[model samples]
Target chain A: MDAAIRFHGVGKSFKKKRVLDNISFSIPKGEVYGILGENGAGKSTMLKMMANLCLPDQGGIEVLGQKPSWELYQKIAYLSDRAKWYSDYTVEEALQYGKNFYPDFQMDRAEELVEFFKLDRRLLGKEMSKGQEARLQFLLCFSRDVELMLLDEPFSGIDLITREKMIELIIESIMERKLTLVITTHEIDEVEGLLNRVSFVKDTKIVVEGEVEELRLKSGSLKELYREVYA
Target chain B: METRVVGSYRFILDFSQPIYEQLVQQFRQMLAKGEIELGSKLPSVRDFAVQMKINPSTVVRAYQELERDGLCEKRRGQGTFITSSADQVAGLRREMAENALESFVEVLKILGVTQEEAQKMIAGVEWK
Candidate 1:
């Protein structure tokens, strides 16, 4: 299987505090992989490294078989909880921004997603609720025809319906496109059935990693495995 | 645990087990019992995955296994359909019954039931 993303002996530090230590994993092409951990467990750091938002202090990382760079950004859609919108930018303006920036961004698909998510076209980013903001963020990310999508904590602070819609969109995208998706999330149950593989990051290390169904057969549900490891 | 209705088949899944295996097992049981009508069109892999909130590959695997077992067949452009052969359905029914009896006998043996006692117990059941 071709690897869409690979990390070899990767390490990261923040002000001399070890954040990730010798972490290594590879996501195969078209696989839905999950990065799971409690807050500050270096889950986001790993995703950011994949997206080239941050650099690893040591070792190397590969995205789509090549090193992450501005050129490779065209094939990757990276979405985090970080605010990408201007405070005053309306939903319509944000769609325009996506169109202007991402060459692969499909305006028609964005319009359809906007309708599916029931987002108000005139709603300003600052005026949107958490769930609404998440929907908008997902719309922007999902509309792009990128081969790899790195979503960091996509379900955080969203309502149940919003999460369901987001998941539906994720599932639809996977079925429609041959996409390799890497999502960092604490919402395990929501994404459990969707993930082909998962890794549990604890104290700057990958304590557990395997195919979801294989691990479940040995250790029960992914939720139970997490509890057993983190408890 | 999650319950989903795909086509005429009602799926109550055990998440601890591999989803594709559970789906294939359910389809087998349903086919044996004639619950899933012969020649009925099964849900497309994508539609079933979306409906069940599971990965499409899981559905594809299950469908493939069913096809391999002769419980279903996928026609190129048209979609998968349940086996229309009564002989195949009967064979599955007999296979399932044998499996059930094998496990039941094993349980009786574990309980220290002799062959004669097990036979007596089997005879004591009221046939419906």
Candidate 2:
């Protein structure tokens, strides 16, 4: 498989707290990978580095075989739990803004997703409910025809029904476009079925990474293994 | 038939065979024993993941295998369901058991156990 992203001896820190320590992993093209960790496990920080929102304090990071830069921004779509949008902008306006930034943005898909999530195009971002905002964020990120997508807590704080819908949407998008996705979530069970591979982060580093079934066969159960390793 | 409510559908399946093959065998057992009723809702990937504390992705793969084998049907937004007919399950079980037996014999032979000795040992073990 082609390499979509690579990290080499990557380390990041905020003040005295180290977020990622000597992290190294390679994600293959056209694969849905899950990054699993508890709170404060460096998943978000690592994802930020991959998105080039934050530079690694040490080592190197690459996406689609190149270092992330403003020129490569269009090739990557990043969604996080704290997706910030102009509060006064309407749903349509948000889509328009996204298209301005990402040349490959799919306007039709964005419109379809807006309708799918039942978000009113006229409604301002600030007026939307939390779930609706989340749906909007997801729609915008997914509507971009990018090579790599980094989703941070995409399902967090959503109701079960919406969460399921979001998961289905993500799966369908990946299948339709063959986009490489890296999702970070604490709710492993929710997204576990959708991932091709899983990587566990602990002590500011990736401690486990491999195909999901192979890990299950070796450890009996992933939950058991997680407790054993991180307990 | 009394439906035994298994708290979670997620199974931490352990067998000498591969994960997908092991899942197929377990589904067969569930069918043969009538533990899973026809058209009954199998555990959702999330529910199963929580039950087994495994990734939902593994459950999805197993469920996909079941669908491919015509042992289950997936309903969008709903959970997977067991096929109504028992014939398919029975046929698959027979084929799987044959393969499993062959593997067992091969391992025993590798361990230098004679057929007679293996049979004797099998006879000595009590089936619960």
| Highest lDDT scorer | 1
Chain A TM-score relative to the true structure, per candidate: 0.98, 0.94
Whole-model lDDT, model 1 = 0.90
Per-model lDDT: 0.90, 0.77
lDDT of 1 by residue, A81-188 (tens): 785554689999999999999999999999999999999999999998999999999999999999999999998889999998998899899999899999998888
Instruction: Tell me the docking grade of candidate 2.
Output: incorrect
lDDT of 2 by residue, A125-201 (tens): 88878788888888888888888899998877888777866876776676467688899887765764456777999
lDDT of 2 at A64: 89
Docking class of 1: medium
Report the error of model 2 at residue A50, Å: 0.8
